[model samples]
Target: MANRSAQDIRRLNRFEVLRRFHASSGPRTRQDLASETALSFATVSNLTSELIGEGVLVEAGHAQSGGGRPRALLTLNAERGTLIGVDVGETSVRTELFDLALGKMAVDERPVTPEDVTPDQIADLIEAGAGAVLAAAESPRSRVLGAGISLPGLVERERGVSTYSPYWAWRDVPMRDRLAERLELPVHLDNPLKASALAEMWFGAGRDVDNLVVVMLRSGVGAGLALDGTLYRGATNSAGEWGHSCLVFEGRRCRCGNLGCVEAYVGTAGIAETLRALAPDDPLLAQADGAAASLLTGLAARAAESDPIALAVIRRTAAYLGAALGNLVNLLNPETLVLGDQVAAHLGERLLAETRAALAGHTLAQPLRAVTLRLSSLPHDAVSRGAAALAFEGFLNDREVFGPVSRTRGVKARAEGRG
Candidate 1:
């Protein structure tokens, strides 16, 4: 009975250590965990042993000590489990597999035409992609702890539902439950922009910063706000719908039935339409029917090389983005402003310069100096990575959620101790 009780206590301590590890900093030693968790050294040691035995924690070299042998440092084993991330965008679906350490093992992307694409199709594609990635990594599907799907719309994380996606014409979709049912895994659903912000917060530029604004200018414009180290998803999970913000008094009509919205000017369709108007004689229009992707890729390439028409389109879009960013900076005063999207990555230095110049002209010199503006490093796969990170967060929080085998082992340990 005493040994059984000790095993129970150690199991609880293991859960506590994993929970705290997600939020805490630096490599933790047994002593460090003992002090932080308010547990005795013997308890800490036993719990650490359990975690190490389960392959959840590993000795990552050692820490220096004033005297005697150095203490062994422990960290979560990133390769012990797998996480799957799905990015469901308007034009395409991207799926990625990552290890617990957050290393991307494999990625797959497929073009999605909404007219023919159904929720089932999207989910199947994600499953296939994840399976392929796992096969490539030689990892078993049973080892996948959790999966997260990032959608381009308002998402209620707790309810695991998508409230709306004007682009996809979806409403009240039970995205999480459906994916969970299909994959037989714990699933999480979130807004693509919010996922992007989370990715930045944990792994990218916003890692050390507390307050940040992540502006994603992809096929559409969206923003994610992180303040004081926590994500700010406003009432009804519609906080960062910056794309719908009114920019012009009576500008072009938006698909959302709004006039002069930022999306009307900067969305991929909007840009392509603008390009069509500017270059009526261009051959892109002739091939638009069957070669849209190639055409867009070509146009993006031309823009990167400073083509006059493409540069003009990019300049105009950047100006509008800058204007909106200035307002955001003044309102939020975030420590860092991240520009994320396909366009930002393609244009690179030129895009940054234009965005900076626009901000300089609009924002106050003092505040502008304080705010660090940069493009995202994970340009193509950021949203997908964010989804994986969400799963990683869940994995690190509770072993039962990720490591059912370990939970079973803990139970067996208790029963045997009692026996």
Candidate 2:
């Protein structure tokens, strides 16, 4: 890794202070922040002062004191700015608007089919959704700090390109630049894996855990890794393409044109295929409604009603999911393995238990004992929320990347519905 410049270190330090402030339940004094972040009192004070001056933080009364004057308390200024998070899935584009506090203000989803997707088409969808949310919230574009968009498949993050999208068959699509031009806002692009991992780290199951693996089980499956408290992008920034890992030799073909990938057996299409194989004449399989999400929901409902075929399908899926998760546990030894996204949300604990049972057979006892597998507690909108978290981080880490909006202050004045 290259050495961090003095400016970079200052940015990180400022971000660390803000991170602690966001995570705190109430307010904090500079001394409390110093103790928590282990920064010197002077450093904490300086950072807090800068943030307060920029309207990123506000004084929140004062802390109790045994003697002398009470210390002033500080808290995040939710009205400081807004953020946009977009989840561009094979089936739809989900966009959400959030305040500086990461509270959701509005959300919108637009249907999209993988076969019909193009860089321009996806960008248009994202722009439309963002505009809808901002309009719903009655917020101006100038208040938007930045937008974080998560795409499926391999993403070249630094270059803002969708290097490869198995679902859409897209290669080297310059998505970030396209969105930036259309929205006229700073844009950050990454895949769902990284976005989901960031969401988990910030507000979901991995909040307290350093080593976490978030397995996104949708039409396009992948893992987002957080190792040692940071997102681990591999040398090529495609580290978490766990879905494409070979699971069976010469088995089912994957959307990525690979044979026997983990996603071929565990993703939404994989689960549907499993149902078809178990009962070729299954009514759900022959339904005119072609949405995989609807099919999975129906299957999950049947499983809940104790249908034998659905139960069996669930078991079979568990076996595949368990094997995939077990491999992850054995290799990464993550503290938590979170099952997230649409399909996982549909199956819930039934899949969790069965997968745990199946995972036992594949994982070594030592690693299995150390890992805890659970369904993600985040809402179905995890990807978009995570996308927003990404934008938030980018803004905090390097304010310049967010452009002029973030540079200006007086959020307190703007919060009163005035520009």
Candidate 3:
């Protein structure tokens, strides 16, 4: 049994090596793979053959040789498997399909109305979006590896449940099981902020940095933290609830029933409300009572032009944002600070400037100076891409991290009358 287990472990490692090789370089010769993975040529050749036989890999072409025999190049067969990534936002659902190589093949979106959107209705929308993308990509359903859903909330990843979502009014929802059943595929779920952080770690600004913080400022605010090269999900999987952090002791009331929370000042609704109050006669503000996108666009345009009222509102918001960020910086001392979401998309540079100024005014210059503050380059799609990345990582790492070991242990215990 010990020998068999060892063989299994070795096979898993070989499979991982092959996957990583293909992931990084698209295709490579057996000799090149051996060199890259630091495995024996015979081991590489054998594993490549096994993966090819399994239809996970294929011989793409021959590699050019210097003087000896040309080597056959192996590439991942993307058509062999698919993965779905769904971003379930407060007002919309975005879905994407990725091939085994993690290349996005297709994407679609649907608007969601708050009054009529239930958890199950939102789930159906996600399912429909995933199906649409898959069909558009011409990928067979049988080849789907899994689906990943990302939302704004506290997700208990272990239980596949959403503990709470303030935006969606969801509590104790079994999001993963429902989606898995509906789509007939394995499902993974996570918070949208954390998903964005994972996306950053995999392909964005946080790639090389170990200690980092990702603050997403959109309709709402949230943070994703990476500490010591691992995501730091706190005791209840709600570590980086930046939006709810109280900036003032006796300030304005927030939707989360808090006083002077960051969201009360910087959230889309809050900002729009402030704008309306300040400039009651402004045409944009007059027309933006319940229109989120229009209000945001108008606000962005005014801020970009440095309108006095808009600038004042933005500056005040920036001050609060900066103060909050300073506290976070002092606590974590991260290597990078990523600003994302809709607000960041428009006002990132100015916000970063003000945040830095506030940090300089408050914290010690040295530690804060080392932290790189920047905005997300992936606009409009950060959460969705991040959701997709969450799915990808779950598929790749679940077995190693969470999969059950030794089926015989349960059987043996039962046989021994211990159960």
Candidate 4:
């Protein structure tokens, strides 16, 4: 047990070291890594030496110095291996291929019709899409380190089971096993809430902030929480199901069969419901059945033009979203609350301003003052990028299985000082 504990500690330290390199824009020196990761200088030296020997990291010359010898700089070897991140939404299955440094190499997306609801159907789509993305990148499957899959609805990470999917009425589907069997690689499963939060922590607005909240708006609404610089998954790993929390008593019916849930008023479907309620004859309503992405895009476009009915829908949705967000602010008191996903990106600052205004009315003076509300800086493919981050973490945990880079296999070892 003691040996195992020490091994776990070593692995975690290695992961932190590699994560710092991936997050950094340029090469990092040994001292820089020690300071950033809070590891001992000797420990950093040992880990970096091991990684350098494995070809996962390579020395990139030396840093400039005013006096004395310059420090050697280290950076990730992009040829180490590859990772894949897949986002399985209600309307689409998008896959992204990335190098060891998490730089995107290729992307492939396939539409998901309403009929494609079964686990096997979705898994097949994911497998095919990942293959297409790898082919686009001209990367062989043998070089792939692993894959991270982000799905909508509740997920059981340890068991790799999807506990529930509101759109498809799926219960306890073994998603991770299914994908691992088909892809023949290490697989990590998580909900979009967790994936989005990880993305923010690793690369977006939450990179510097310790406490943050990421609210994702799409076909459904959810919040991902990062408290004290760590994701709080709760006891059951279902902590971020904020969208299902009741917002109104006996109000609109939600797709989850719950009345007055926050999602019923703020999700893409809920926004469309509001539009239909206000103006049933609106042309955008015609596309709501299976083309929700188009409908929301149209709604945002109409709202941008200051169309009365569209603006009304926006205003009403903002009020609901703001109030719900206010509750989050008061309870969590996060340093930052980021609005993300396609819906938030489409509405942009117009919706942000109104939500902020509405949020002020509901939150306490002190907490509200400390919290900053903003849109996500990540691209529309934030979820998939985050999924790739998941794969990266998995690789760091069990790197021995993937072995060393093929390109550096037979190279002669250089001096330890340079590495």
The candidate that achieves the highest lDDT relative to the unseen native structure: 4
lDDT, candidate 1, 8-106, per-residue tens: 544534545554454456679998877765566776787688778878789998998889989999997877888999898877789888887667888
Clashing pairs in 3: none
User: What overall lDDT goes with each candidate model?
Assistant: 0.74, 0.82, 0.73, 0.85
TM-scores, each model vs. reference: 0.80, 0.90, 0.81, 0.91
| Model 4 Cα lDDT, one tens digit per residue, 292-360 | 778878878888788998788889999999999989999999999999997798888888999999999
Cα lDDT of model 2 by residue, 1-419, tens digit: 13544444455556556766555578899888777666777777777887787788899999999999889999889999999999988778899999998889999999997566888888889989999999999999999989999998888877898898887788998888888999999898888898888778767776667689999998888899987666788898888889999988899999788899999998888888998898988888865145887788888899989999999989999999998888899999998999998878999999999999999999998989989999999898888988897787767645554222211011111121211
Residue 262, model 4: lDDT of 96
On TM-score, the stronger of 1 and 2 is: 2
Query: Which regions of candidate 4 are displaced past 4 Å?
Result: 1-13, 37-40, 400-419
After superposition, candidate 3 runs with Cα above 4 Å error: 1-77, 287-290, 397-419
Tell me which of candidates 2 and 4 scores higher on TM-score.
4
In angstroms, give how far residue 343 of model 2 lies from its true place.
1.6
In model 1, the runs with Cα more than 4 Å from the true position are 1-55, 64-69, 284-300, 303-306, 396-419
RMSD vs true structure, all candidates: 8.0, 6.2, 7.2, 5.9
